[model samples]
Target: MEGLDPRAFVLGCSAIGAGLAMIAGIGPGIGQGFAAGKGAEAVGRQPEARGTITSTMLLGCAVAESTGIYGLVVAMILLFANPLVGKIAG
Candidate 1:
């Protein structure tokens, strides 16, 4: 058989890019888990400070969410912008 068609090649690159983008999820998962554990420990130590601990935990989690957002942006770029297509076309 002949080599892949242009569309097929673009699709293959998109698939690879999607996989790479998903890998970024790992960072947020680990970071959020750590933040959750710390929040629990803090609440356990000072029951009266539960509110503060919860707020801080949520803030940290929100920060961790940024990594996932980055991943989504990358995936979107891969699916939409698809820089590799330009190279292939050239």
Candidate 2:
């Protein structure tokens, strides 16, 4: 780290932070998968309410996916439009 310039260090850390941000995606992935499985199970038990169950499951999945989208946005900003590099370096 001593040999690295401030810009390089900031950029490297920003990249790592971006990578860490993407870890938030795992939660939504797992939540959606669980919701899908439960939806399937519910449908199997109540075939008559398939439409209702499907809609609810989709809504839940959409809500769950928002966190992943936020993570992606944060990662993208860090990777492509990092303001910290300039602030810390300049």
Candidate 3:
């Protein structure tokens, strides 16, 4: 590690972190898909309640999406704000 260039190492780690962070998207995708399925089923069983079911499903999807959004923020920070690089220089 001592032989490695600091900027290169930081960038490499940032790439890895960005990749890992993107994995967070999987949870929201799965949750939203499941919610959509359940919503469809509920709507099928009670056509009159479609409005309520759809709204509830949308809310759940939004809540689930927060995790993915956080992951995106982390990735962006790692890529752009990379405090590690500055600390290494100082």
Candidate 4:
């Protein structure tokens, strides 16, 4: 750390943060998979309710997917439009 440039420090930290942010995508993937599996089970149990089950599952998946999208956006910002880099005056 003694000889590290301020800008280099900021850029390195931003890269780490962006990597961490990308991990957030995992949760939504798991949730959507679980939802789909459950939806399939529900439809199997009640074929007449297939439409309702599928629609609800899709809606839930869409909502869950937003978190992943947000995480992606944040990661992209951290990697490309990093504000912290600008904050480091030198």
Best by lDDT: 2
RMSD of each: 2.0, 1.5, 1.3, 1.4
Q: Estimate TM-scores for all models.
A: 0.83, 0.89, 0.91, 0.87
Question: Residue 70 lDDT in model 4?
Answer: 96
Collision count for each candidate, in order: 0, 0, 0, 0
Model 2, stretches more than 4 Å misplaced? 1-3
> Which residue pairs come into collision in candidate 4?
none
* Comparison by TM-score, 1 against 3, better one: 3
**What are the per-residue Cα lDDT tens digits for candidate 3 across 24-61?**
99999999999999999999999999889999999999
**Candidate 2 lDDT, 1-90, residue by residue in tens:** 567698888888999999999999999999999999999999999999999999999999999999999999999999999989778734
- Candidate 2's C-alpha lDDT? 0.95
State the local distance difference test value for candidate 4. 0.93
Q: How far out, in Å, is residue 15 in model 4?
A: 0.8
* Tens digits of lDDT, candidate 4, 1-90: 698899988898899999999999999999999999999899989999998899999999999999999999999999989988778764
lDDT minimum window of 10 residues, candidate 4: 81-90
- 7-86: candidate 1 lDDT, tens digit per residue: 77787879898889989999999999999999999888999999989998999899989989999898988887888777
